[model samples]
Target: MLDLTKLAREMQGISQHLSQEAVASRQRLELAQQHLKKAYECQQEVMERQEKWRDRILFANATPLEPLNTRIDIPVPPKVHTVIATDGSQIAPNHHEIAYCYLLNIGRVVLHYGQNRYPLMDSLPEVFYRPEDLYMSRQWGIKTEEWMSYRRTASEATVLAELVREVGTGDGGLGTGRRKTGDLGSREENNNQSLIPHPQSPIPALAMVDGSLIYWFLEQLPVDARDRILPPILEAWSQMRAAQIPLMGYLSASRNVEGVNFLRLLACPHPAPDCVSYCPNQLEKVPCKVFEPLRDTALWTTQLTPGQRGPLWRSNNRILELYADQTIYFCHVHVGTEIARIEVPAWVAENTAMFDQALGLMLAQVQKGCGYPVAIAEAHNQAVVRGGDRTRFFCVVRETND
Candidate 1:
């Protein structure tokens, strides 16, 4: 074993240095606290005054904002419901290895909640050896890891869509509602009112993904390559929407500050007829500049209670812009004192019943796993490639090839 004396001394010195830096940082924050408070006040004031001219901000297409102070307590899920989640892991290509290739694995878990929680697990691992997979294409100019990541996300979506379709259209799925001794329209009205299923009614199911529906990295590719890569994702999304399966992207310990950016937009002190072009330098000014460093989770931490979720805020990114009509919305949620960021598409957000049901199931999943979603946790567990497994995998491949 190595001697600890020298290592201990070095660690002590580093710890002391970190402590001094922390003290200095706290002092700096204290100095800026007043400016941040003033910036927040300005943001609230501007939002109040621009109620009628709200479209001005939307037209600018910078950061979008909903009401920031609203919070809703998600309801508990039904006794008998199903949640399906998918996650992916990758082993990137290593130049030192004999083969110039990459590996991707998608793991899926379906949990049925009833008298007892039953889980179904599945995984698909793919190896890429094509010329396009091993080298950067002249057309796209993207590395293998980047393109493979998008492909994996598309694969996850495809799997989720297929699962949802199977459940929704299968026997005793959502399509088969309980027809009581009444007219068809009356039965439809009754089915709409009830959150739980009737004896013969189709069971409700939700399909979840570990990340956002819109793959933002697709922006890195050229138009032609982007078109080629986008059809699978779009088709999967379309299928999910048509199937009425609420798809959620859950991010634990998310550090996104999109909400803070929106507040900064509102706090801009410039008096321009058009905020985007004319007020370019407004953010560098006093109040807006103060909030530039704060994120939504940090700013709203004190406002949210356990199990509470905030109002939806629209995304202003280019990918969301590409699908402006079918935009994505997100909100912060407090799960057992740990905050998480959740994203859903416009189709789920617009339907109140569906949104409530989806959020309820998510909350239940988190409760079951303390602070994280159980379905996602199991999927990750199945997808992860441990160090020993990775070594053995390469060794086996080499042996087979030799």
Candidate 2:
């Protein structure tokens, strides 16, 4: 454990530094707020010149698709809409272990709020030990921990896509009439009740995941591994899009400064942005220093009302250039508890109706869970592999091997 007694002096020093920074932070925020006001006054010009900045900044920042200050009210969610979500957890492989194995546990959830559908909740735990799984991992020259996370991402997407296809094909098993118990605790069959989709009238649903859709980590691997791993995930996404499902990734209490960074670009005093010359780190000492202490969510909270959502912006990243149709777009919305960041693919962002409804449904979900999305929270509950479970898993493997 940690010796708090020994850390007292260090803690005091840290506190003193924070107190000094607090004064500096306020000055940065004030200058940023001023620049934001100027941008709002000339919003049209700002939008027009957005394309030019991409060439100058040469870094990832959110480019507003519409007016910077525009806010859309959350449309009231439909009385009968379904929210389907999937989340994942993993047991990373340790080299010291006899079995150098990793496990991925995916939680699948279907919460039907309409007339005839019952919710379905289940977890899928997949353990990899096959030569192909290990062989491809070793080829990347990365740690098993890093490699396992990539696998988990692919697995989670595949699982969500599979469920979306199931719902699309009318095999979701959500049926009419309530089952004797609430939701299925495990994968047991509810033979007593009639299934959810009648195959005639399918329910409208929204698909969600608990984290980012961007597979940035996959870029670190070799071309062979990237080709091997990313295609299946892209294909899974393709399936969801082909089925016309509205999929999203929900990030709560996000401190992402992509929006603020865009402000930095706007606030840059350069006729031509020569970052290496004038400003490098965007520090208080630099030319583009106004937004240094600000965050996207914090800035948005000051602007967005309880029911309003900020504009969707196409996020810039080199990895996204290859995504083609899967390029990411994100928005900040006041979800009562905090200003939450919501990310979606290019198609959803392009479709006006889908975008509004997506926000509304997410807001409804947040209200249900008080501060977070209920489907994601429940999915996390199902997916999490606690310390006890991890210990027992090794014990079981040891016994089986003996």
* TM-score, every prediction: 0.76, 0.87
lDDT of 2 by residue, 199-301 (tens): 4765667899987777677667788777756777777788888988888999887767888777766776787555655555643376665566578887787
lDDT of each: 0.66, 0.76
Best by TM-score: 2
Error of 1 at 100 (Å): 3.4
- Pairs with backbone N, CA or C atoms under 3 Å apart (clashes), candidate 1: none
Separately for all candidates shown, the number of backbone clashes (residues 3 or more apart, or on different chains) is 0, 3
Candidate 1 local lDDT, 117-184, one digit each (tens): 33556565767766755664444667677777766776666656655765565421223233221110
- Provide the lowest-lDDT 10-residue window in model 2: 176-185
How much is 397 displaced in model 2, in angstroms? 2.7
